[model samples]
Target: MTVPRAMKSTMFTLDGRRGVMLACMAPAAAFFFAFWLLPTARLITVPAEKGWSAYFEILTDSRYLESILNTVLLSLVVTIATLVIGAATGIYLARRSFRGRQTLLALLTLPLAFPGVIVGFFVILLGGRQGLVADFTHSLGLSRVTFAYGLTGLFLAYLYFSLPRAVASYTAAAEAIDVQLEEAARMLGASRWHITRDVWIPQLAPTTVACGAIVFATAMGAFGTAFTLASKVEVLPITIYNEFTNYANFATAAALSIALGLITGAVLFAARLLCGLSPAR
Candidate 1:
């Protein structure tokens, strides 16, 4: 009374897959539509009765322009910092067999596990007025310099999170590189610096760029950290959040979200293009 093996295998075939997959996929797709696509559609449809007038108004606003610029600038700065710090740390961790490598890796990625709010809190605690910086400044009879609620604090939080992401991404990429190539370079009288600059860097450039772009986007869209630290910061994300929550201006929020989405899409698209251009074979 056992079922035939061929029939069982056929039942599991890709073309004959059951309702389970379809069922699962349907819910996921609906979730995406409900959470992401539907709102986006509403934003696009509701605002354009006058044919992109709202878009034009948003683009032309000084505040909007400033927010866009601020977001881009902050993201770029954080991206570069993450790339440099993360890549260098990754290379070191990947190459050298150190005693505390595992521990160090965990420590580096510690911030990633903590919520962004906690990172903001930590930065405020360490760098805010009446925090360590302020206490030290007062002790030395110097001006009590403030680090909370500004670009400096926001950047610190960004770097905290971004460095971990960069480290993890670049570490994986670095580990994939063949050790013999580096050994060969060194044996041929290439200095340590020369080996890194010529041999290691070229191989790692594409991965670094791809990871940097991701970190850049994350920084651009970051809300919790930016909100906790710098309400006056005027980044695109903060603006969108304010429009939706504070002002109840869903139209403007939608418009800004659409704009940010396009910019993010373009950045990621360019990164993919760059990734494709690299030698695969």
Candidate 2:
């Protein structure tokens, strides 16, 4: 079989392009290996240094178990709240246009600009001992109210942190949905409830799962807000930090880190699979 001369040249050109692309990516690959991959490889093997029983011991510890539970519950709550409220707001914003709509959107997305620690501070200002809630209740001749250092504050801070991402994702998903489906549903005598339940929910389900997984993962691993809120905040990240920093228990810390990562990664993987994506994708 005779190959065309142009085809031969094209194949050579393609090979050259592939080589160029690989060369361009080599620095990044080296940087990732030096900065991330090597450290992660060492960290992943730290449990074996403790004779492989380290993970079992860490899991058996009541404090570690409680921290893991608390982290999971908090993350689940934050993800659910973000999804529900964010979905509604996103759909509304996508479907409606009014004065100051852009302003409202800006305000909605403004939380993304604030880091977890800053959000923790904002929560403190709202609910701290000498903060707005305390002052308000004091003015009303009531007892001082504060929750800034508690689980409640942590939840609020995480929700605030996760909400922006959910809203942005949901808004984009909602906007990308074709309106003609809703019109057809309406023409078929579908009520508002029917249209929403049968049409909108199905359309937005993928975004819900994907965004929920991201929010959950973020909350599961968030440390800055929990740390800033209080040293007493019982979450996995804080536990890991304390083990590594305060106690110098690197093995325990590594085990805890692995556990947290496994849970978060499992959730993300399940979500991707549920949304009909392969692991390669």
Candidate 3:
């Protein structure tokens, strides 16, 4: 039997397309293997050279355990606080227009331009000794209240960066919500609070959760701010730094890094799953 001309053409076209796709994928595959896969394998295995028990010691050792708990707690608190504050502000900004609205948004999101170190410095200037708050309180003959060197200061710095991201995400999500559902609820004699509870909250929940996860992950691995304030704070990132640089404990540092990475990755994976199940999706 002779092959049909159309069949030959179809096969040739498919083969050409497959060749083009493989060619396009070759660089990415090579890069992933060279950079990500290799580094990750090394990170996972290096700690094993000290034995698997070293990984378990992260949970048993008081110092490492404290740092882990501290980082997790701080990230969780920051994520929750940012979502609460950011969702309120974002919904208002998305729903209403007023004079200076643009300016206000610009100011709120201005922190996005700042690096982590800059955020730490900004926190210090707000609450450090000789900071504005300290100076004002002292001028009033009140005892100075400085929190710049502690967990409070680190929390504020994390909040500074995380809030902007939350606001941006929430604002975008709010803007996409259909106004008709809210209006329909109101027409049925629903109060503002009722409408928000019954209509808006459900719609926004997934986006809020996903944004909170991002905030959590960012807070978990944040190094520059922690480094700037390390004298008073002992987050996991700082602990890793100390182990690697100060103590030259490569195995411990690598193990701690892997632990942090795993936690962040797990939260992010959960966020992605939530996003996939979102009503919007």
lDDT of 3 by residue, 196-276 (tens): 898999989888878988899999999999887657769999999999999998889999999999999999999998888
Q: Higher-lDDT candidate among 1 and 2?
A: 2
TM-score, ranked from best to worst: 2, 3, 1
lDDT scores for all predictions? 0.86, 0.90, 0.91
**TM-score of candidate 2 versus the correct structure, residues matched by position:** 0.93
RMSD of each: 3.5, 2.7, 1.8
- Kindly list the per-residue Cα lDDT of model 1 for residues 1-281, writing each as its tens digit: 99999988887795556676897799899999999888778778866765677688789999988899888898889899889999989988987897989999999988888888888898889888778998999899999978877888999999998899889888888999988888999889999899988778878978877997799889988888988888546888889998899998777777888888888888899999988887762
Better of 2 and 3 by lDDT: 3
* Candidate 2 per-residue C-alpha lDDT over 25-144 given as tens digits, one digit per residue, 9 for 90 to 100: 999999999999998899889988888788998778888888998999989988889999999999999989899998998899999999889999999999998899999999999999
TM-score of each: 0.89, 0.93, 0.93
**What lDDT does candidate 2 reach at residue 132?**
100
Q: Name the regions of candidate 3 deviating beyond 4 angstroms.
A: 141-144
Clashes of 3: 0
Collision pairs in model 1: none
